[model samples]
Target: MSFDLGLQNTRALVTGGTKGTGAAIVDALANAGAQVIATARSIPADARKGVHFIAADVATSEGCAAVADGVLAAFGGVDIIVHVVGGSSAPGGGFAALNDEIWLRELNLNLMPAVRLDRALLPGMIAQGSGVIVHVTSIQRALPLPEATTAYAAAKAALSTYSKSLSKEVSPKGIRVVRVAPGWIETDAAVALAERLAEQARTDYDGGKKIIMDALGGIPLGRPAKPSEVADLIGFIVSPRAGAITGTEFVIDGGTIPTV
Candidate 1:
């Protein structure tokens, strides 16, 4: 199985790869012998081994151009691209509480990065005749919590639809486009967000988690998925083992989304 991965010397770019799930993905790819270029707004305090860090915010077109420039200049082009940059800091009062700026920020963070990156880098992939692209969306797109992430959910939903559409256009040209929807991933970001939620709900962290879980219909696994688990999945999807897999949305939500 490991041999089938065939990731040795593969060139990869992971957006938002400094911390949380992004860091995990970078580690997984690096461990598999891929040359990983990880991009984020800033450098991480504890960086991963054998992964090159490039500072950039993928949410902006300028940042997207910077990434594409760095990749092209360094490696000519990346063989695999995993988009892992996105989040919501909008107030928890639902749509009415969100202003235009917040909504636009959410869209820029969650949606435009993927769109802009693809537009800039896909030509190189097509020219090379093979590549892999993974867009990390969210379960919120499907099982939305409007009070907390209405704009974020909307943005991710757009990302998912865009990924599906792009996959059909590129798969035949030897480029694979896949979307991954992860729910409640265990990360430092998740912990910090939980702390805020705990404060707002006037409960302890565990109690706040319970409240959040209850609203989501509960994770049957009784816990969020580890970032490494999702990273491993992303690693596999981009590897030769999943070469036939394309244009699909894989949900690693710990069964939080109970839909079939």
Candidate 2:
């Protein structure tokens, strides 16, 4: 048997695509023959080839507009958009540690970018009568770490709900919207953090990684996922092969959530 994504010549855009999971998604789609446009606040010197790079923050209204304008001016519209820009800088210490400003920042980073970009870009897709949207959320939405990532978790939860609502509103119009919730992904940054933890704990890198995994209530699969693994799932979700899949959340957590 053979499997094909049928992404040839398809125009796609990925936010936060300069690094980590976003970069992996960019590569996956491009390798599948899609013409990918990727965005970042600053284009790295070693940015990947085979995809157009747009420099935009996407975490602010102005930045989202710039990205939308650039893509529209160039491609008129995109067949697919994978929202991958999100993170938190809020201080850890549970609820009281976060302020209104921090809460807004989390929302802006994790939720609003997807909302703004979808609003700006969806009209073109609606006009075309066909498109796919994948919002990269986090398992933290369901399995939140109160002390460390509460705001991030809340924002992802909002994103998940928004994704479902958007799909219901747009699926009849020929747009497919899906949410992807990833668990810990072993990216380069994660590896570096593990190394730091190892030094602090007087342990090896594996032991350090184990410490973090154990804190997640233990991943039944024995380790966190690879960035490429998440990207591949997104690649398939946006493909014609997944035409009937929409208005749903796919959790790639290596069974870390520990719930049915």
158-228 per-residue lDDT for model 2 (tens digits) = 99999999999999999999999999999888899889999999999999899889888899998889999
For this target, which candidate reaches the highest lDDT against the unseen true structure? 2
Which runs in model 2 stand beyond 4 Å of their true positions?
none
**True-structure lDDT of candidate 1:** 0.91
lDDT of 2 at 109: 98
Cα lDDT of all candidates, in order? 0.91, 0.94
- Positional deviation of residue 172's Cα in model 2 after best superposition, in angstroms: 0.4
What TM-score, computed on C-alpha atoms, does each candidate reach? 0.94, 0.98
In candidate 2, position 23 carries an lDDT of 90
Scored against the true structure, residue 257 in model 1 reaches a CA lDDT of 87
